[model samples]
Target chain A: MRKIYFLFASLLAGNFLFSQATPPPADDNSLSMANTQGLLRTQLTLTPSWMMKGTSGNDSTSISSARTNVYLHGTLEYYWTEHFSTRGDIYYFLNKNSAPGGLKKNHSLQVGCSYHFMKGMSLDPYVGVCGGISLVQISPMDFMKGDSTFLPNYQVPSHLDPVWAPRVGMNFYGQHVFHFFVEAQYLMGTYRPAIGPILSINEIRISAGLGFNFVILHKEATVRPAI
Target chain B: MPYSYYFSKLIDPNPMKKILVFAFLLVGISAFAQDRKPNKNVGGQFSLGVRSTISLFSDAGSSMGTGAGGQFRIRLYNFMNTEWFGDYLMSSIGTIGTRTDYHIGWSVMFYSPKQKPFKKYHPKPYFLTGHCFDYTRIAGNNPFYQDPNHSVASRWSSAVQAGLGFHIPFCERVDLSLSAQYMFHLGKDITAVTRTAVNGDEFLYIDKEEASINGHLLISFSLNIRCADLWHDHQKKGGARKAAPDPDGQNPKHIEQ
Candidate 1:
């Protein structure tokens, strides 16, 4: 757990340092030409998420939204020449026990597309859908086979789930190299177990993060578009 | 609270709530995308984004499930682009089990952009068709109260889906899209049930039966960003051109530098 905290601290420090050192871009989102494709953005984000449960499948309840967990997400994307563009994402969710065994940890891989609808001079609103798999580890399910006590250990083993997240949010860039964004996402976990009563895990995550938006072009092409 | 206490509650009895949220977001995005005139500047761009989905019905139990997926798209022309996508969804069956499904496919997205120069938000409607591989599995805990079942089954099927959708430009490089489609699957089916046998040993019974064909309704909402702009500046500055060139074209001396 200490190692995890150290890792998160290091990442946060790195992001802050990078932002401080790099000069803000002149052709930010708002300043760029309205219709043409702008900078292709490589975004690195960190969020503290609230993980919660929806309802009961049996008598059991999973993680509640009250628990704040750490989430790290990275998105690689292209500037849109068309109406939409594809995106690939990988997310690491800090320890939040939604499954039995002990504390639970998750690694997720997802792919989807983003549609830019409401473009703003500073703030742009959009929505999208992402689907993928979450590889998870939970506490061991066995209590005491024939130990000191005769209680049953209800935790289940680690496994993978088919999951999806639908998100709606906005991107804010005021002609700066670093951008700000906040979005709401619904995460649904589909893991079926063949033992005691268990409920499905669903959660809502609202994230706020910083982004580095740049482009790949030739030297002559680096000239900022006319404002 | 103890992890065990809350962990068992992970299975949601009200699965529709999640489904409802997903649907609502899709509608909301489409409406937002279409509200204004689109920028209408289709260029050479590649993008990466995340997609979220909800399965309307599972053939086994007719239950809705939640899933996540990804897509990689390349612009082929002003009116055409190709996308490769893959996703997985998990559904709940009563209190004991879940069904897992996987889909991987590619589609040709044909676009129609109105030739309005100064539209606020552009509306680009598209049509798509693609083939995918589908796999599903069913698992439950002990078949009996104190007994165990030894059988578990899973199947992989080939599938295809065709649908119509709209891409609403949210920003210069961001797009929100909603698509509705039908999927057809060819494979075997896996099922698990509680059963008692011989001397009354209660065990879980899992079996694979021939599934002639299967199909379902699929809806997807996505947020995608184009990638070309990321390397634009570095490339324009002759970042790569500054490096020593390879004489034979097979190897570059800059790699050693």
Candidate 2:
């Protein structure tokens, strides 16, 4: 455990040094890790996505149903390079699925890298993949045709399943710090249990939204002198 | 009277009491002085922030739940600030199911000076300690775990947390912060969730004991919207303080905007 902690500390320290050593990019077009003026490398995106499939009864899962959902998706992406960077995102279904007499609310978090194609163009297209956790909460199990022994208090039960997604998107950079993006992705695996045969449910999501990115240069080590 | 004497007076019999006294003293002493910047940093001003905390309960070694919270920070001086925050989170512990938590807490933050520590160039670091009122409820009755005779209910307890972290300025209006705090909840430990047998035939038989202490390691990320400095620059323009000229104020060490 001590060795592991030491290694982790070393890695973090190294990252800090590297970040400080790398100066902010002068040109706004090229990607730099540091957030600076015109280099608003971090982008926050909000999109209302139309899901191809939602919770429907007997849709490959006993506890799940099939329907269509229009939900809001938000993402924050940081581009470390003109074509590459890291992204973390969280999304939730706006309306709950009432397939099994319970509210089927779904939310997920994912982290991955994106590769942008055509660096200098006004429209930059990218593809990416990420793996994270997806949680499905269903409850009021009085509807389950099983013994009341497992859930004495017909309450909400949550399942956390491993999830993954592959995304392809195009970004339209405009005159200012804000831009527009449209993305399509297919998500794999849901923690929801299947009644008879298959393991879980996977989903496909497509969305378009606007984002704002700001780059802040590092403060020099020296303190500011009082005028 | 020498300021050191007042500092000595703040060192009280109880450690918690000492911290409280020290906090008040720092705030009072800095309130009357106008040497610091008028509005650039977390000095003598208030900032609002959204705090997201991932709390990992000791019962579930690797499992963690997330909380969305907001905080108000008041910078008393260059080195001290006070924060008040509240958060709510839901976590699934093993098979026992979901556990929901609501915590309201306050912390005193002590900032490190401008000098970089460990030779690693990073944002400013602060040491924090505070107390919280935590209310936790089990989402449902764990057929295998809950007390058969007792009602499935919620528990409220007092907790104290301490940790260290960084405050990174993203821009004039925004600051990004990251911190890891260890919190010990002093309350009756309820069976969070239960583990199920692979065959689903029998409830896993194990030692079900009474636990009174619950601990969690919280990692939080926050984006703070800092306000302007409390004091105006014109306060120094009166020229009264310049007449007394700070004896050792040649090149100030900590330049805070």
What is candidate 2's lDDT per residue for A38-139, written digit by digit as tens? 233344444443333322223434334355554567677755445555567787767775544444666777665567776545577889766566676764
DockQ of 1: 0.24
Predicted candidate 2 versus true structure: per-residue lDDT over B1-257, tens digit per residue: 99979966764334555557766886776666755432322356678876666778776322466556678888776678888998866554332334567899999998765422221123778899999999876533324434433324467889999999887654444456789999998886665333454545322122223547778889877656656556432335533322222224553332342
- Per-candidate RMSD, Å: 23.4, 19.9
Off by over 4 Å in 2: A1-68, A72-98, A101-142, A145-171, A175-179, A183-206, A209-227, B1-42, B60-62, B114-121, B139-151, B192-211, B231-257
List each model's interface RMSD.
16.8, 17.0
- lDDT for every model? 0.62, 0.58
Candidate closest to the true structure, highest lDDT: 1
* Local accuracy of candidate 1 as per-residue lDDT tens digits, A1-227: 35545655886897688678545555445343233144565676776665566554444465434566667877875545433445667778765665445346667776665676753345667787666777765554554433443335555556677676778888776543556778777877744554544544566767677776564543123224445
Error of 2 at A57 (Å): 24
lDDT of 2 at B112: 61
Number of clashes in every candidate structure? 103, 15
How far off is residue A130 in model 2, in Å?
15
Q: Please give each candidate's TM-score.
A: 0.56, 0.53
